[model samples]
Target: MPEATPPPAAGLPELPVTWRASRTRAVLLPVAVLLVAVFCVLARAMPHNWHTNDRVALVVTGLLFAAGLLMLARPRATAGSEGVTVVNFVRTRRLDWAEIVRVNLRQGDPWAVLDLADGTTLAVVGIQPAAGRTQAVAAARALRDLVDAHATARHRR
Candidate 1:
């Protein structure tokens, strides 16, 4: 298994780092564009006798499908010195480094999951294996390091 590169000298990574599922975006974006094009072509090909509303509805349904695909590609995470922001499909949440107890990306898992101090696990879609296992492992390691660094600092105070 690939390991993440070591953290910086300060025992913490650089602030304001962002992670995204590049593969997901690469796949979904083009599909979305293609869907729109197909819808336009289909709309124009509809029979002249068909109701305008029916044609419009067909186009609208295609648009909605494209939108849904875009949403699936929307997951990302940004980590700063203060906290991390997680943006999933429909919800966004922020958490301090101390709030994360562990960062796990086990084999066969779809994405990284954060074991929180509150005993809940939060899925981090941004660091998914869909992007590549090496990338996912590196991200999970880096995040774990950040959480550890923060926890250590907090205990000293």
Candidate 2:
């Protein structure tokens, strides 16, 4: 497991901070996975002689349920001195600070959007407005500050 924020420093800002998912996800994901696991386990322990189709169905269902659990982890964006790491529902990306052009968190938007220099954008889904106004805004500001701090340092050299 990666640390949310790196060790405290004297003057420089810390590297490696991550935006996590909502509390709802924190609570629901484990419970759902546990339930599915328990169901599969119990089915396996049943005394009845299971047919090949039944076993296959059980395996398929378990796999599908596990796949769905990935979303519960939600989107996480981690910032380090070298760059940013975005872990979305299905994919992960790493980009250096120079690749990012701007941080955008507009009203009515669900989360912070990072406008990349490549004419594309990256959504910071871990900092969702659905979590709460105060939290969402604070997260956006923190991310923006991180980007600004790095950008300023990079420009100086």
Candidate 3:
């Protein structure tokens, strides 16, 4: 009887392997503080004369700022031999390497994206742009390179 080849080791990396944003406090904290300031200013200026719609807008803006701040406060993404992990406020998703098809870094947008085999896209929002444009570009390229190398290495067997 002929011997069968063993499956390729589920080659993946270790955890605590984080891809974090560059300027967490600078980008998010300032915006959050600005939002609060705006809210206070609006409240002081309009006191009781503000319409319901205006009040709603202020509340919604405040919530958005708060959410942004929270996300920035703890920005991190990890990938291992098992899967890719993302952490955001009240939400987390893990995806196996096989699910990822390609990665792309678009200009103007704040982050890179992982194009999945299922026609879905996962945003790598954890990578902040403060590392500067050059670094951001390099990071995006590195991500795409890693995905390609991993996938190619797996299929070669």
Highest lDDT: which candidate? 1
lDDT of 3 by residue, 18-104 (tens): 676756656777788778778757755776878878877886778787777866666556766565687654567887767889877
lDDT of 3 at 54: 86
Model 2 vs. true fold: TM: 0.77
Predicted structure 2: lDDT? 0.75
The model with the greater lDDT, 2 or 3, is 2
Question: Lowest summed lDDT over 10 consecutive residues: which window, candidate 2?
Answer: 1-10
Question: Which stretches of model 2 miss by more than 4 angstroms?
Answer: 1-13, 41-56
* Clashing pairs for predicted structure model 2, backbone only: none
Reference-based lDDT, residue 70, model 1: 96
Instruction: Identify the runs in model 1 with alpha carbons over 4 angstroms from their true place.
Output: 1-12
TM match of model 3 to true structure? 0.59
What's the C-alpha lDDT at position 80 in model 1?
A: 81
Model 2 lDDT tens row, 1-157: 3323333434444666777667647776777688678767866876678876786687677767766776756688888867889888778899888788888889999878999999999888877788677777877887777777667766665
TM-score of every candidate: 0.89, 0.77, 0.59
Ranking by TM-score, best first? Answer: 1, 2, 3
